[model samples]
Target: MISLNMLSLSLILFSISAAVFLLRRNMFIMLMALELGLNSAGMAAAHFALTNSQTEPVIWALLFFAIAAAEAAIGLALLIMISRKFSTLNSDEIKELKG
Candidate 1:
């Protein structure tokens, strides 16, 4: 049985992750926050599924994990390129693509 506390915690984690993504100027921290957001979302889905006896949310969480893995790979590659070009991992210093 999924409790209200689990749901509330998941929401709080997701919100904090989003805030971190938005507020952090460091590219690494932002990437970590994005992962955290994905994880919290998966947790929420799983918790809801447990309450309702549904398998769809479990499947969704698996899909999310796969997508998150792909995203992490791509994001890291981009970060590497950015760092190589700018010599810094800070987003503010790596804005060469800005118009």
Candidate 2:
């Protein structure tokens, strides 16, 4: 059914998140990976809602979607601050204590 494909797509998205978060040294890319993981989780919840023929899961997914949006906004704000302070988006370079 459609739910099955959605679940499979969620799994693939999580895998992509893992790879991007682990392999990339850029902070923006890492933030994108985090968003991907969040989206995949939302998709999985939607899949469950569809399979169960219920509205509660769908509502919960909507709430999660809102939270994800807020998280993205906060994350982008932080990204701006970090880039301004560190002058670089590289994860390794951003770690230095510039005292």
Candidate 3:
């Protein structure tokens, strides 16, 4: 019923995000796609937990969201640094990343 629809939507979201991640060359777009994929996974977990009358999976989903948030923050920071250094966000353009 509604659960099936939600799961379908989550699957669609994951699919779209994966496609965008694979096809896009811009670092920002890739980061956004990665975030979309992570959020879709969390959404699916929460929906599954709710349908099954379970609390643990929901908690795990929430933790997953927190991790996603932290990842986005760090990713953006790195992206900004890279953009500043190279003056571009295209992954293909930035050849050498020396530390």
Q: Against the correct fold, how does model 2 do in TM-score?
A: 0.90
Can you tell me which runs of candidate 3 are displaced by over 4 Å? Answer: 97-99
For model 2, name the residue pairs that clash. none
Instruction: List the pairs of residues colliding in candidate 1.
Output: none
lDDT of 3 by residue, 28-76 (tens): 9999999999988988987898799899878989988999899999999
TM-score of each: 0.90, 0.90, 0.93
* lDDT tens readout by residue for model 2, 1-99: 888999999999999999999999998999999889888988988999999998888887888789889989999999999999888899887656666
Best-fitting candidate, scored by TM-score? 3
lDDT of 1 by residue, 1-99 (tens): 345677888899999999999999999899999999999999898888888889999999999899899999999999899888788888777655756
Best candidate per lDDT, number?
3
**Candidate 2 local lDDT, residue 84:** 95
Clashes of each: 0, 0, 0
